[model samples]
Target: MPNNSNENSPPKVSRQILRFLVIGGSSVAIDGICYALITTWSGISPDVAKGISYVCGMLFGFWGNKVWTFESTKRSVSEPIFYVLIYACTLGLNVGINRAVLLLAGDEFRLLGFFLATGTTTVANFVGMKFLAFREQLPADSTTSAPSSEPPEVAIPVSDRRAA
Candidate 1:
């Protein structure tokens, strides 16, 4: 049978990816604006301004991804921990890949290295955020009932069973 409803709608994963990108873009814009404002209007140093803006962006990204991109309802203490870990790993990956490409390809290919690193880290971030950081955890007891002392029941063919 044809699934008409499914045919009309994009897959759930696609929607999630789109939402994730939107959230990421927004976060970047927020980071840039905050950085500019801090650096321009305040006496804070550029490095400190960058750090503050980065934190602001990260906080917004976390909330947006958790509430909108993943549509997660139940909150776990480990979710933020996982998010931070994933981001940290990706950040390292991005820098390492960029540096490697620059070393191998020369400074002339700086833009190329930058793009490669960005692309790799973007994909890694998405996958990690989707599968690991935002994954729902089931309770240990939810998968099983309390153990019973009785033997398990076995089915018998109706024709072979004795009449009550």
Candidate 2:
């Protein structure tokens, strides 16, 4: 059996990355669908619709990443909060990159800007989710409670003991 401690093995990391990409694609689809529906069918402002759709996508991403992609068993109340903060930061990064690219390259390269923003934010979100939001936390007593490196003492009864 594979050792559990060696979680950073190439195969394991590859699997995690693949799962992350799948979840990311699903999240993006959810975001796009929601955005389109809200913008086309409702009176909501486009900006507000975007925000709502982003949140929906963020929620799905968090759930999928936590449960399937990362497979983290450690739980903490701060996980969701950290996830939201990370997504918010990535959202700003995405918008900034897209706008900056458009400004530099002109509106003719709008698709390039979109692709750049999407790619950059995707990478950022993966890093943030892996390292911050769902990282496994060592137990509080792990250090102090570690087993001794010395061999365990073996008992010898008088009948079993022989003179050296």
Candidate 3:
């Protein structure tokens, strides 16, 4: 049988990915604006400025991804810890890539370096958060139910039953 409803609807994974991308776009904007502001107004180095902006972006990203992107309700103590660890990796990647670009070619183009670095981490962040960080936790009710102890009643065919 053809599933017309399914044909009209996008796959769940695709929808989640789309939502994630939307959230990421906003995070990037936040990150870029803050990076520009901090670098423009302060004496801080680009690397340091970017670091601060990146963390701010991550904070927004975390909330957006948790509340809207993934639609997760149950909270686990370990998830936040895990999220921090994953962002730690992402932070290193973003900072390292941006600094490397600035050192090599984008010194005059700070935003360019920022974009290049942000591009590098976007997918990793999504995958990590989708699969690990904010994945839904199912309670026992949502999974297999507890087994029942009662035995099933059996009926015998009239032809097979004896006098009884």
The model with the greatest TM-score is: 1
* Lowest summed lDDT window (length 10), candidate 3: 1-10
Q: What residue runs in model 2 are displaced by over 4 Å at the alpha carbon?
A: 1-5, 35-50, 139-164
Give candidate 3 misplaced runs (Cα > 4 Å).
1-10, 90-123, 145-164
Q: What is the lDDT of residue 101 in candidate 2?
A: 94
lDDT of each: 0.87, 0.89, 0.81
Residue-level lDDT of model 3, residues 1-164, one tens digit each, is 43335321458668878888988889889999999999999999999999999989878988888888888786788667777888789889999989988888857978988988887787788788877888755455432456658674589889888955
In model 2, pairs of residues that clash are: none
**Which pairs of residues have clashing backbones in candidate 1?**
none
TM-score, one value per model: 0.79, 0.73, 0.59
Q: Write the per-residue lDDT of candidate 1 for residues 1-164, one digit (tens) a residue.
A: 43335321458779888999999999999999999999999999999999999999999999999999988776788889989999999999999999999999999999999999999988898888888888755544443566679887788889878863
TM-score of decoy 1: 0.79
Predicted candidate 2 versus true structure: per-residue lDDT over 7-97, tens digit per residue: 6778878998899999989998999999999999999999999999988998898899999999987778878988999988988999999
Give the least accurate 10-residue stretch of model 2, judged by summed lDDT: 136-145
